[model samples]
Target: MSPQEKAGSGPAKAEICRAFSETADAYIIYGNMTDPDLYYASRFLASDSFTYILLASGHEILLVSEMEKNRALKESCVRDVRTTGEYDLRKKAAACRDASFGYAGVIEELLQKENVRKAAFPYNAPAFLYEGIRTGKAGIGVTLAKSPFLKARSIKSEEESACIEESMRGTEAAMEAAIDMIRKAGVRDGFLISPGTDRPLTGAEVLTEIDRVLTEHNDLGDETIVSCAEDSADPHGKTYGPLRAGQPIVIDIFPMNKRSRYFSDMTRTVLKGKASPELTKLYEAVRKAQEAGIAAARPGVTCADVHNRVCDVLEEAGYDTIRSGATVGFIHTTGHGVGLEIHEQPGVYDNDHVLVPGNVITIEPGLYYPGLGGIRIEDTVIITENGCRNYNKAEKVFEV
Candidate 1:
């Protein structure tokens, strides 16, 4: 088995130690909060650089700057938080093999102190660190290995699920605000005007509405999708201008909680006025397909099974999907996992991964055409023992 497949959940010290011990004596990770693995293992976040180390004994160590030492101790699960000063980092921090050299030195120092002979690093390990180790210290054996953090994160703990559900509430609230605005919009000369302003409502305004509501809940909407008419044809399309009255207005919101740092995803399509007969059919097909996808997300089911269920529903409705090698129509994965990062592991697509109880994923099925515009409905859900628990409470209303 690959290292990832053999690993356990949640980046626990024992799991980390066992995950990388087959080929090396220790495992190390280096990065900032942007590195989800770093945050997951250390439970510590910082803007600047930091390092995490795990020994074969299941002991964990964290290295950070002095300014961050106290906060690391207060926030992180790692009890052995050390500042760079003790490793003689200040002197070399200036003119090392690059900025990473100084930190790499600190990492090497820790490995030596812990009596580590061989160490494995993530596949995406910092290049400068390799240079620092190769050029500065020559004793330790280092090699590239699977991080195992992704596999660990794939199965959400009860606490992680709670954080995701909390963030999902914010996403739902923001989606509610966006739909309400579109519903109350007044149509004039084939364009949607604001309810009170009498001015044409642009895609930008809808995005603002999403962000404004997310802010109230201490959540941040990063690149939320707000597209209208033909713009909606592209899944991640971002456009601006007055919304078409009878065409689809696709709004996909993904918000992350500021404090918890967990993400939630949801999407809804609405119309300011009335949808055409064909548009209505398109919307219903996507909605039904989403239902099928959700229904197939039970434990013991493979991800490919869930995706195929969605495809069957959409195809039975006379829509072309990737199954037929079609370029357009229904052209995306059924869903994906959500956690500290927006897109995590155990994708609900063609992959053959068996669904597990703790896997939190999204069921989003969409149909898009340049001429017909687009229609999509998405919901965040947790895969339960028998079935799935949906986090979204927003109704799937096609017309405003």
Candidate 2:
């Protein structure tokens, strides 16, 4: 289903309307489905460019090409669904001999029909369209503004939360399949081999399994990480060789649902063979730190506070962090919000955003050692009134 149909009511539309009223007489976002703001505002996903305008007069319009006219009308929740053809797009293009100028004329005509005195465009709106409106006949006062849809999306609607939760469940299935493969693999020559084949288990093989399982669950993985040994030392290491035995294998899977376009993030570090004393210690520290970060996440707590809570756990356990000016050890932010995009708002780091209910985030804490490998544990969660609700129910086991 389209985002509009799934939402029942328009998702984020109320917040978008409020921002539209506060920012300018009218707020405009121009782009394709790639522009999260445009997609959120229009509640329609189109590959080609489109326009969504919200007027202070409480009117909203979605303008699309004739090719998408019927789809937008059926899939989008906006009351005013218009087509460029209705504005004599071809005639205007022929008159100016420039499609860009014709598109600008169409936008100007739209504002004129509504008597829009001043309008606002997202900071990332099409430069040509923005410039065209600025250099138009009506002289509409256009100001660049932040994407209101992004801010609105930070707080997910119920349907959005459900979509993310479903994706996380899919992630659990994929993670289980990967970990099970590692657990059942036979160790030989200090490396893991497939259960039935002599071929050494490769990152490529595990990643393929991950995607296959995710696809079965209506989800898809992209650049899913399966780093081990020295490669695991890098936060986003990419390795595709034989899987080493008795070393930490970091499997970070972040996948999006095919239908909802919502994402889920999760990470797990597991040792295929036996873990050394130091390796166990490092893994335990990271686990404790992640738990501390999740515990600190709540409606009233600040993101910085939650991040610092994790740092405190790591530091107390004798680890250097970015806070201590260390280049290695516990680097990177504690976590970040997750939703339509992998990274959204209410960042769980130095950002001073106060956590609020409905804010979906991830608490991923890790420690990296260039030569000694690394360990990371992560989970997606939603801030609740009292504390937080973890969407991930995957078992956390360090040694397979």
Candidate 3:
């Protein structure tokens, strides 16, 4: 399913107004990114601009650079958009009679005239903008609020779910392509051999094949993970290693769809020959832990309870790997909400947040042994009234 075909309606102004009513008079959904690695933040917040327009919030401005004006208009929902360069900063500052007032005073004056009182901003708003409002001598007060707008964004509407489902499908297809390439390359004695030849595949070659397969879909931002052997010990290892017979290969791929911006994350452990007894046991334990964590997800379970359940299962199976603590079966949180953002709210940790219907979170539980490698089984799931629905379609078995 393409993003165009699955794209659905988003939250209305009235809905957002209700969500942040007590938090602020108006929500300033700002996207301040120093890099363009993740392009979805601005688009996700644009939904708020559309809601504000419908609510008639006097004016909702999306300030961007001159270069971003055209792209912003095409992608954003706000009509009253402006570029920072268009305004004369010196003139605007001079307009304020109080020399000490500065640009903050000028902006406060404009906002007060519009009858705006309090404003809420995104979690990552710039320090200058925040300090300006905090120090501004305006009689109107500006209170900072960490409104979990993304939390509300996590629970996908039917249309949003479909968009993510399609992205996940694309991700799975790419993973299949990478795995097939690795297997058919005829790896031997820790060296990958090219098809119909004895030439060895470098660590770089495996990554190139993975990147080529994923980029064919276009919406993907970067190459997916293709960790092998010892590198797999680190949850987020960056370096790649050559694949060889009997060595465990962990191929984790996550890519966003070009049109919808919704992404899919999936991991599968592979091998060209039989896995060691210890490695196989670790794999079974992690798979069981992941399944147990998923079974604990429901409408009323607390995040801590779900996490403790996985911890208990892993400990009982004697697969717990604790470093600093007395025992550490799983070091990280059980999972987190997934949607517009790769990592969202409703975190499955030892926190106190209650699970609710419509919540979509990952249930990834694993064990890692230094020098021995690690195994983790992760899947995205939607919480239902009765249970939950798993979105991943890949099999979990590890075989040559």
Candidate 4:
């Protein structure tokens, strides 16, 4: 088992320790409010800025607000948690004319106490914090290094996989409820009618039902798509308006667990009634292409190769990608990695990323046409040593 799996927590501390050893004398993270790296490092959610420093001398320190210091001490991964008050930031701020420079001076004093002259930070660090470090009189040198941390986060631990799987279960249940709503609706005057009501069903109503189900399971459906017909042709179109019978309806749900902070994505195209010959052909082609992509995703396989497999299957069926100026075919990449962020790393595109065990990715193949609508089949899976284990359990039936 890897160190991350053995720790039963987030990434191993040794990993961070090694980053400090190789990247610089110390590694610093300024804020956890929107930084996944800080959250990963501390294992605690902070809505404000805090300092997280890991020294090459095998020491970890977290400087948080007084209101959060006790909570951080209890919930954080690191052992040393101190409040900013302990550093006398107000007294230090009085020394510098610029408030930003004052904050940097205080941090510089703390680093000097530890004898740290060289440090590293995330490449996407906040501009204010980067400027502070650059202008501070401590003469500390900083390197923008994010690759080591991103690489560590790319391969998930067993516990992280379980969290993702649990999130997928709730997502799949919500998808089932949405499809059931469509399956039980009555067809009237070329529009789907809500059961026991004369009003026509709308995509908004379906999305409402989906969100209701997800909320019940402690998941939030953010920007869920329940598009139909022409709307479905545009991949990211918002769900709206009345639903018509015998037309393609693309239902894509990406829900995140409120507690675990992991996301799950799944999509399926369904028709209220019989589908036209052209729509049926498109659905079959997309489904086969998705299967090809999934089959090609295995340990030691390159992500580009997996994407090419899907493209080959689609092109052979007389549908080419939009990149080739074809308006109604595969327009997007095959898949992407999923974890704390909906889109993570190891993107399954025409890139050189090699698939490995513990990598969780998605395989979604789609085909869209202006007049006929769109068809997409997606499932989240984990790459194993030999193959991938698919987490999506929803059936792929076009006609409801």
Candidate 5:
């Protein structure tokens, strides 16, 4: 058995330490932990220092700045926390090969005192420090290793699921509001203002209105998509333009509710004018494909299977299924695990990852055509013992 298994709290830490130790005797996780996006301490405290203390069998030390000391102490479970200036000013500064050469020197000294020889860290390790270590001043063998952090992140804990569920409710409300605005805007009177205001509720207006509604509700992030007409051909296009009467509008709003940093992503297509037969057929295909993808999500199925089944449905309808890379019938992956980070592990693509009961992913299947338009139907889902539960409450019916 591994050293971690002998001193186990659970698999999350165990997996992390095991991956690190395989590559090195020590790990230096460098990050601007202060960045809210990097370590959303308020939402989920999944920090490297915390993992090291709980998982590493040998001594683990953290080299932090003076400013982050108190926050790290309150948030991290790591005990061996020391500041960058704690070591000798000149010696530590020399040891710091790059910007934080002082910290690097201190880390090397700490490892030496602890008799650690092998060390690992991410690619962003300081250039000078890495070179110095290679030259033998650090007295440790170093290698970079990809930590299995996201795999552990894929499964949601009870508290995390609750937070995500709450975020989902906010997203559902915003979607309904956008639908309402679309209805009202369709009936509003306006004249073609020419190059200036040819369209009253142009594509840009609809997109902005949706954001306006979500902002009123609170805790919604700024990232939103409001694409219309040919612009919708790009799966993630949100350019400045107007909404034409005959074109389809794709409104995809996914924001983190301010109350909780958790996120919810959902997409819907609305046609402002009469829906063409071709447009209706494409929309129907996307809807049925999303349903099929969700239906295939269960505790025992693999992510690739769910993706393949969805592709089958779209291919049957004679839409472009295979992507040569950028141009694709389904340009993006079927879905991704969601939690503290919107896109995490258990990728819904042709891969080996298995679906577990606690897994939550999005089921978004879409078809895009250049100069024509695009249609995508997405729903966030959770895998249950026998099936899945969709979190989206927005109606799937067309507005036209």
Candidate 6:
């Protein structure tokens, strides 16, 4: 069954309407494809481009192409799905020289039919689209409003949490497979050797294995990081080159489920052989800092408080942060919310946002030393009334 079939007047729609009521007469979205806001508003996933309008009267409408009208009617969250052809878009386009204006004319006609005088749009709407709507004959006024959909999406429902957990399960399985490969590899001349080949293993080879495992679970890894040695010092560095033993290797994997569209993020630093004394010290510090951040992630706690606690742990270890300079020590935010998008709201930084139940977030702490490398540990969790529940079960071992 489609998502819309299982959904029954969810709170997302009510929250969106409440936000819209405070801003404009109607909330309008126009796109040739699915925007994150539109996907959240309507639980219906559209493969093709379409327009969605939600009125203050609680009526929802979808204006789609004739090719998708039937599917929209059967699968969309909105009951009133109509074809743009019904609005004479093709006829209007034939008479008008400007295609953009012609499309806006059809939209304006629909708004007038609904008696909508002023409409609110997402803040990222294109300037051309805004100008087209404002210049239309309907005399409609447009305002670029911050997406109310994001506020509704910040808190997960039981069903949403379950979907995220399922995604995390697959992520952990893939992560375990990657770690297993590193554990069983033979060491030759301070480099990790491939199991089947005598040649040294490369970061691309490990990432290929990771993607293979994720594909088996119907997920895809985009820009997955598997950096080793010097490359690990740069947090967002892409994976490359041969793997070396007795050095830090950061494997940060974030994969998205093809079916649910939810994502899971997990990071673990491992060494194939014995870790150097300095590397060991860095790992321990990061692990303890991560624990402190997790401990602070409870309902009613502020995001700034959690970040500060993690910083305290790292600073106490005599490490520097971005506040000192860009080259070393603790950098980046503590963590961020994960869902349909890998990074979302309630960012665990020096922000004043309060943690609430149903808020799913990540607690990642890392320290980087120039020339020595970097060590990071991360886990996704859901905030509960008392504390947070970790979703990742992968063991945190510095040396494999």
- Best candidate (score: lDDT): 2
Total clashing pairs for each candidate: 0, 0, 2, 0, 11, 1
lDDT of 6 by residue, 130-219 (tens): 787898877999898887777667787777787788888878888898888888888999999988789888888889999998999888
> Could you give the C-alpha RMSD of every candidate to the true structure, in order shown?
3.5, 2.1, 5.0, 2.6, 5.1, 2.0
> Cα lDDT of all candidates, in order?
0.84, 0.87, 0.63, 0.82, 0.67, 0.84
lDDT of each residue in 215-255, candidate 4, tens digit only:
98899888999989888888776558899899999999998
After superposing candidate 3 on the true structure, give the runs of residues whose Cα lies further than 4 Å from its correct spot: 1-23, 32-75, 78-90, 93-110, 137-139, 321-329
lDDT of 3 by residue, 152-244 (tens): 565566766777787777777776776676667775666778667777754566667666666776547465666667776766654455566
lDDT tens readout by residue for model 2, 112-220 = 8899988898777777788888999998888988776666778876778888988988999999999999999999999999889988999889999999999999998
- Using all chains and alpha carbons, the TM-scores for the candidates as numbered come to 0.95, 0.95, 0.80, 0.92, 0.83, 0.95
Where is model 4 poorest over a 10-residue stretch in terms of lDDT?
2-11
Candidate 2 Cα outliers beyond 4 Å, as residue runs: 1-15, 18-23
User: Which stretches of model 4 miss by more than 4 angstroms?
Assistant: 1-23, 94-101, 322-327
Clashing pairs in 3: 190-244, 322-328
Note the residue pairs that clash in candidate 2: none
* Shift in Å, residue 178, candidate 6: 1.2
Residue 280's C-alpha lDDT in candidate 4?
A: 93
Q: Please give, for residues 62-102, the per-residue lDDT of candidate 5 as tens digits.
A: 45556666765665445466666666645656644444555
**Number of clashing residue pairs, candidate 5:** 11
Residue 44 of model 6: what lDDT? 60
